[model samples]
Target: MPRVQDVPSIPPAGRADDGGALPPVLDVQDLKTFFPTDAGTVRAVNGVSFAVREGETLAIVGESGSGKSVTGLTIMRLLGRAGAQIAGGEIWLTRGDGNRVDLARLADADMERLRGSEIAMIFQDPMSSLNPVFPVGEQIAEPLRLHKGLSRRAARAAAVELLALVGLSDPARQVDAFPHQLSGGMRQRIMIAIALACEPRLLIADEPTTALDVTVQAQIIALLRALQARRRMAMIFVTHDLHLVGDVADRVAVMYASQVVEEGPVADVLATPAHPYTRALLACVPRQQRGEKRRRMTPIPGTMPSALAVPSGCRFHPRCAHAAARCIEAVPALEAIAPDRRARCVRWREIGP
Candidate 1:
């Protein structure tokens, strides 16, 4: 965790990119979030920027505690108000009919209304997110009841439908069961059902398959893809798995220490990554091929710099194999490396893979 003072803020007025017209769902620019800690303020999301277009899956990939989940929480307006401060930035959210809203500036009351109904989220941990005391049906129905003002009976009926839609068998009977009665996968499915209660235009799925088995993970991924195609909903899929991102994401945004290191179309970014950090990450993912004697996976040399003690220049320079003296002196800007691609490395061009 880098200290607040050490992490440089991205210019509030971000680059005027000709990435053509903005996406008709979510646009975030220079977003920064900090938490007040006893040691110092921890810069969780540092000048991160990206957009999720309508009906497209934009994946944010990073290691644990890389501010991936924090970015999603910030977008959902779930950040704590008292000690957790949104230091700076603009979040432009577009509605169904090409209308745009500055989400960062919206009041709490306004944000509350937009959440669950317009923009929903499936958090990382289903067990922690679901209410232990409430029956699963009521818990799922709560969002629909509040957002749609459905009658209790109607909401309960709809909840069963949602559960069934997520592939739960005997949804009507299972609805009356409590969270403890369900398996981990079932609880995650319930969370998805609750998130989709109102058919949100955008879904932020933050590591939605964290605790599931490999088979269940594949099922959940397929489920999300199916739902996205059927509903035409924009999504921000946050996960550490590069392999998983390639499977479903249209575009990929790589994050390290609360900052975006590389971003581009998923295929191009994965096939030919420009950032050293991105390359290092990809090298670690296992590939199955005959005669492929397992080589030591190239881990990004050192551990991630603590958010509280973030390096002065490029935060990743210390771990970056291509680090130069200049990297220690000045923070690198996320400059365009090619069309529809950007990287935060001064030597990206010079240091070819």
Candidate 2:
């Protein structure tokens, strides 16, 4: 069996981007994650690839179970060893120096050492993510002590600082309070503080505002955007709503049936979606345009395909409105339909610009 001690550590830190106007901080290529289920193999993430550049926010937009969440976990190497594993491809992450390391190939120990210091993740549910027993301040300080090599006292002080940074009230006293003592919004703020504690280059926010009220949701999104700008960190914002994407994302990747059906600039792609799935999702978003009081939101016709028994040709063919005979006969690879834009459907052009 492969072991942590046997896996080699990546080279010394180098420049985050090799050298370009906006070089990639994370460059994923042909990533495939599979689970060995009793019923059948579950291809949770199949042949997925995307690059997040320095200081850019790339939103992975999709409905539940489209593998958007799994993709983030895979990048962080958070999947447990027993059930699922990365079957193929590379996850190239640029070091502080100009060089890059393939995270997929890194040893478990190497990944652990890098996870908090270079990459951080904020899960969907803060209440569940935080420990009821431990104080939230201690939770935030744990990573600082572990990865940043700070003393317990120093880490605690830093935790208080982080709390203030995230805009928590009375952070000095709040630092000593338990998770159960905090409100839902405050707990989410704690999660953000913990995620940003290490000042990581990449922040993977997995539906951070899903549990908040509509008003609170907007507040959290604005807070995150401000933090991202102040920190100048590259972010992978995972969510199901295009509405949320519009607020924080510079680019967007629409995932369906465990694959990215379309990708491009946020404004461009939303304005003129290339894939049927993208258009369907956009149609579902509540919009107010022109003199119309409100546009009718149309839900996508069918549910996402089962990963265990994905459709043979296009995984989305059964649910795709514009699926042609060719779409059902051959699995279309994600290819560029236009400069800086890509879609998986072979007949994406026919669907419209």
Candidate 3:
């Protein structure tokens, strides 16, 4: 194994040797991931496209079963080789050599080589992701040892340092404790340590802060943002917390019915949403406001349609408040509503902020 610094130098996303902006770190195009069941194929991800610039955070936000997590898993190829697989599109990642490789087409063995060294994922539910019997330190060290070729003793030492970096108390003692022995926050920090062990160029965080309390979620988000800046890494943050994306993500990709419905800067999308689904989601979050009576939460009128039987034309048409006759007959492409902003609604112009 070689030091991370020994890798070939790649230009940042927004700079070039020729005085122009460089390519994005990760470019996903028309991605589709499906899982075949006895009943039907589950279109977990459908025609999703987005990009992550170096040192930028792109949040994929949606309701449960809307396929935010599946998109992340598809990028990492974590769904494995057997039943579930990518049915279409390219996941183009910029190599350290300044060249691009399509992860979607890489061989399994070759993809495994990139898993920890070039790309890492911080999974949700540390208790389920981490080994129950093994000490958390050992679990964290496995990636370091396997990817970095560190000796057991050296890996253990590095594990303690990583724990401390993530703000775990008594790193030495914590390293030796099992996953069940730690608090939810502590376990999450351990998961972060493991994901950061190799200093991956692209980090995929799949709802890592979901289970933690408000305080802990804030801490983890802050830590992740700090780490991204310190390491200058590109990140894809998948979560259902539309409220949290503004704090950590540079951009937002709103998913619905397994497809990207909107994409734009965090402030623009959250403050003045263009899509009906995005607008409805914002209305649903619990926020603090001084009022005579608490404001009512306006949940989206209908539940998301099942992936096995997505609605015709626009996937959100059945639930859209402004659904026109054409909406149910013609699928709308994600079109530019502003500079660097896009929405999948045909009536995006008429949709108020």
How would you encode candidate 1's per-residue C-alpha lDDT over 1-353 as one tens digit per residue? 10112212232344454558665578898999899899999999999989787789999999986998889988888888646778899888776545566777777777777788888999778999999999999999998889888999999999999999999999989999999999999999999999999999999999898779989998998999998999999999999998889987999999999999999999999888999889999888656579978876666677888889998898888888899999989889999888788999999889874
TM-score of each: 0.90, 0.92, 0.91
Go through the candidates in order and give each one's C-alpha lDDT: 0.86, 0.86, 0.88
Stretch of 10 with least lDDT, candidate 3: 2-11
The C-alpha local distance difference test score for the whole of candidate 3 amounts to: 0.88
Could you tell me the lDDT of residue 47 within candidate 2?
Answer: 90
**RMSD vs true structure, all candidates:** 5.8, 3.7, 3.8
Report the C-alpha displacement of residue 37, candidate 3, in angstroms.
1.9
Q: How many backbone clashes does candidate 1 have?
A: 7
Show model 1 residue runs off by greater than 4 Å: 1-22
Clashes (backbone N, CA, C under 3 Å), per candidate, total: 7, 6, 0
Candidate 2 Cα errors over 4 Å, as ranges:
1-19
Model 3: residues with Cα > 4 Å off, grouped in runs: 1-19, 286-293
